[model samples]
Target: MTATQPAAEAPETAGETFDSLNPATDEVVGTYPVHTREEVEAAVERAREAARWWASLGFDGRAERLRRWKGVLTRRLAQLCTVVRDETGKPVADAQLESVLGIEHIAWAGKHARKVLGKQRRASGLLMANQAATVEYQPLGVVGVIGPWNYPVFTPLGSITYALAAGNAVVFKPSEYTPGVGKWLVEAFEQVVPEAPVLQLITGFGETGAALTKAGVDKIAFTGSTATGKKIMAAAAETLTPVVIEAGGKDPVLVDADADLDAAADATVWGAFSNSGQTCVGVERVYVHERVHDEFVAKVVEKSKDVRGGSDAAAQYGPMTMPSQLAVVRRHITDALARGGKALIGGVDAVGDRFAQPTVLVDVPEDSEAVREETFGPTVTIAKVRDMDEAVDKANATRYGLGSTVFSKRRGVELAQRLRTGMTAINAPLSFTGIASLPFGGVGDSGFGRIHGPEGLREFARSKAIARQRYTAPIALTTFTRKEKTDALVAKLITVLHGKR
Candidate 1:
């Protein structure tokens, strides 16, 4: 769950192209065309036509094609991982993990689309018992998807795969930094869906994304910073297009007094530093019970010592995928130090040009930028609270409520229910994202709407409700020939049936 707007760069004109570079080595990974508005509109038009044909294939027909696409992705998983590592500078294993999750989503969406979206009878109340009611989710024509660079495959596919399974054609504009990965995915999809341009790709920076939002697509699914998400929503409002925005987060981890200190420390280390702390739902702040705060901090510091970032296989994590993000990490560390926070491990110097070493800070002020803002780096702040109540209060104080973790031997679920977040993991880190059946999203500044599971399949569809008259009412209340006594009878019936309640 990581997404952000592209870094500042020179504007592009029509027919222009840009190169994606390896973040760690600064080598050209791939060059892609900067799709202009005209191009984007053309793609949307194509998708509009494709959507008809795609939807013509009923659930079984679409599911069969989706399975074929899934097989292609499975067979070429290694190749896709290489492209992911090359563009994003993540370790191969990390890329593989992301790709596997994406594949799992494709499989789940295809298999469950019928059961989740098929037409079904709906209950008719006593007043409407004479009518037969039913509802079904129908495709919403062409969908526009603006993806993020971090977790490029998984994050975008969260929308793309589900949209396809829901019977809507898609026009995907992947982040400029990871356009190659997007292109690879689109081409692979073409292998199985060659009859039409069901899933098209457009590449560029913000301009291209803006065009996509205005391309007359039925809906837009955007994954990025809250600021960018706001911009997307504003643009979509011009056409009254519905949107699903999966944005940033300032996730927290709460440790109870009876928690397993070792397990909590290990989860913190991995949750904070993995992917160089670029995860949207990753652990950014920790609130531990006063009884175990000191011990937990010490264990986190000891465990994070070996977690270093580099481009090598031996490195625990990779370099910052976006070079501009390094300055943000450095600023957060500097602010924490300037505010009298103590670094138990790496300090300001840990944030190098590309790779940011894991840094653990204690005694950081809750009002400070490091604790309040979304650092999106490999850094975390540990603060002690008087009890679980205080911990929950502090954890829910942030404006961004995306994901969180709770470590407790006895009150795991009890405490997890108290945090005001979209999802929470008990005794684990990011467990919700791994489950294909769970809905993933957030509220407030973390953005709105969800992707994944039945909700995700419905996200790309429009509900169609139907009601048919089954029989004439014995009271004859709706007929013009009804007598005045009929009204009196209905009034008496209403008094007897609902007046009491």
Candidate 2:
């Protein structure tokens, strides 16, 4: 792909910087220099050169380097978790879980990249019988990854690991709220591939990210809000840079009449309130069969009472990572209540200054903001549906179709197949995210392209096809000396071989 025109270097004041603040407390977590467009391009230029070196290392060589990096991550897992906790204000355990998941992806990408992307024999059509064909995936040079703060380590590595495995150097621009975690990752890479700029980090506000999009990177993999994704797509369009967007989602959960009520309630509470409900694939809406609606609601209410958000180790969840999000959570709950919804658990008041208590709202109008928009907080709205068909319909009605869950004993797979989303977990909450082999992404408003498994490896790669002539044909097809009779014979042969079709 051709590089974009040089980004106009924006002027900056000397010593301009930004502070990463802890959401749990109004304390500065870390301070980072505000990188400018010039700096971003310089990083990309270095990455382009580094990409050549990395790709030349080949699969085995690159895999070895990746293994070393993975070892570093494992040895320092606890230390990395501390940075994640300090930046995002999540529990230390949650941070550890995200880091462990990220390590797993690195392992999977290193072990499977060659098998999934290396050249392989491809079938030649009947007309090309004399030709041998093969296809392989090649790196897309340098890639820019703009990641989200929620699950900062696990979410961004979903792209970074695959891009590296596919042989592309990466320039990651993590969310400003979690720059400390990003810095930690880049610093750790130095302990492994210390000689090359294989994985670099650039920190700043949105302008820095925008500058990265306009930079001459070969591709951009972004995971963030739908609105921000649109802006990224537009900026990348200026250079025709390929992009893989993992945007916001208003995922749903379906509770069938035959579902295990106990399990369904438990999964719903955890799925909706985990990480303070900052997950892109979290369950924001619940559709229950009318027969078991009352029972499911009661169970969820009971399960949610114990789910509280605080900065302490004993808290089940943590505060909203982005303090501004508190207002949005409060507004969603207020709207749901004003629309005649009943708060069975925490109400609008539950959205505190730093932490948002697990709030469950029922009887909320389907078209209300709480149900319609992406309320990325620890809040869920449950609605009773006439049947499974209605449940599926309501689940598919939303513009955002990311991840969803279905609780059914017999019809688990059936309901999962009907819903339009990237992934679905049946009778469990968020099991897909743990599986490194499954592709992770969504369609429509949730954005397109994947970031895990084989699909992810291909997302940052370009498919190259090769056709070699194994033997000369008796009848020449591409020679100036070929006669008209030869052409007729070829046409007749094709007619006999495929005309009936």
Candidate 3:
């Protein structure tokens, strides 16, 4: 049993299991099985068998099936949203947004797989002149995914959709906090691919996740915190399996002197509080040019005061999905205020039994824990910068390099690129999360490997370079032929063609 397990869980047991809960009220949402090593190995064996069938379909057939799966998701969106809200205690609208974004990724990956993963030519270099060269992406047998509680659909769907489009069978182990959301998605997928178990669900805690990483699956796609990502990578390394890690983010937004203050304020509030701030790419720090820091801070504070977490239409946010998170939230806020930070809007009282009210802080030291660490709550730290360069410096100072935003009327794109992060959006917040054509992942402690666009397709598939010579070359270098004279002649020819004048 892991920290997420209920208190009634038996002490130190194997093969025992339990149910997932509704975070809002602690009700049993669904029963889940804690698979043993034997069961996990068997699931891998089954997945391998299913992967072969799936890969045999090639791009066209797989794309067609994925299209139907998308249609299934589209038609039954409301029912899925209900499950998402129940499991995670997020607003239904937020759940719907995640579902819609996931649907877009599924459609995009399906529609674009062939172009992204199809065979292509490559230069083999002068040393291998006798060889013809090409490369193509191939399925990596089966892939396992360990997902997170926030954005349960969109986050894991980023890997699942791309993996399926790339022709790999997937075994998904969603966060214990949102197992029902995972099960619902898997069941819906089954309706489209009724003849196969291309997508399998295994439910449990960290042990289940560890089993997946250690399984014979060729790769693992993990989305969680940096601490757990390290553990997953270490486990996968036992099998020398490749892993894609979408870990935590202490992402920052830089507001330039020339930026739009109002848009930046709205983006900051939403980016910080959506999902009650459980997003990996959610904004945690704000570095504003001193010329407009006061105005920007005031505007964001005003907007944040209106956002509340509940199951109602007026609620723009939702409760903390995991109870233990309440403690972590409390700690980060307390440490920030202790270090001279001032809560412009919400404070310690904002965190309640269920929801964490949107909290905004300013006048915090740059080196404070709140500014440097990922709070993963509905909190944002505002800091002033002497100039845009200082703003970028402060934003890039953290260990996380996931998603970053820049609000610059004149320098948005340039600033976005300069930040040491995987994806950066200009003017708006988390726009990269909405675009299917852009690859989503991060570097440094945030994690490596990609989850969307061409990079995503390649991540799920392996490059199988096929080089079939059009005909035997007159000069054969691969065999023990009379090649002394041939080698001399070839060297001379190469010098004549390639020596710089």
Residue runs of model 1 more than 4 Å from their true location after superposition: 1-14, 479-482
Question: Which lDDT tens digits does candidate 1 get at residues 1-501?
Answer: 011212111123457999999999999998888988888888888788788888988899899989999899999999999999999999999999999999999999999999999999999887678889999999999999999999999999999999999999999999999999998998898888777788888899999999999989999999999999999999999999999999999999999999999999999999999999999999999999999999999899999988899998899888898889999999999999999999998989999989999999999999998999999999999999999999999999989999999999999999999888989999988999999999999988999899999999999999999999899767666669989998888789889998995
Clashing pairs in 2: none
Cα lDDT computed for each candidate against the true fold: 0.92, 0.92, 0.88
Q: After superposition, how far is residue 399 of candidate 2 from its true place, in Å?
A: 0.6
Write candidate 3's Cα lDDT for 1-501 as tens digits.
122222211112355778788877888978777876666767777778778888988999999999999999999999999999988988888899999999999999999999999988899776666678999999998999899988899999999999999999888889988888888888888777766677888888898889888879989999998999999999988889999999999999999999999999999999999999988999899999999989998899888878887756688877898888888888889988998889998889989888898889998898887888889999999999999999888888888899999999998888888999999999988999999999999999999999999999999998897877766777777788656998898889889879869
RMSD of 1: 4.9
Q: Supply candidate 1's per-residue lDDT for 55.
A: 94
Backbone clashes in model 3: 0
Question: Lowest summed-lDDT stretch of 10 residues in model 2?
Answer: 1-10
* Model 2, global lDDT: 0.92
For each candidate in turn, the TM-score is 0.96, 0.96, 0.94
Q: What TM-score would you give candidate 1 relative to the actual structure?
A: 0.96
Q: Can you give the lDDT of residue 177 in candidate 1?
A: 90
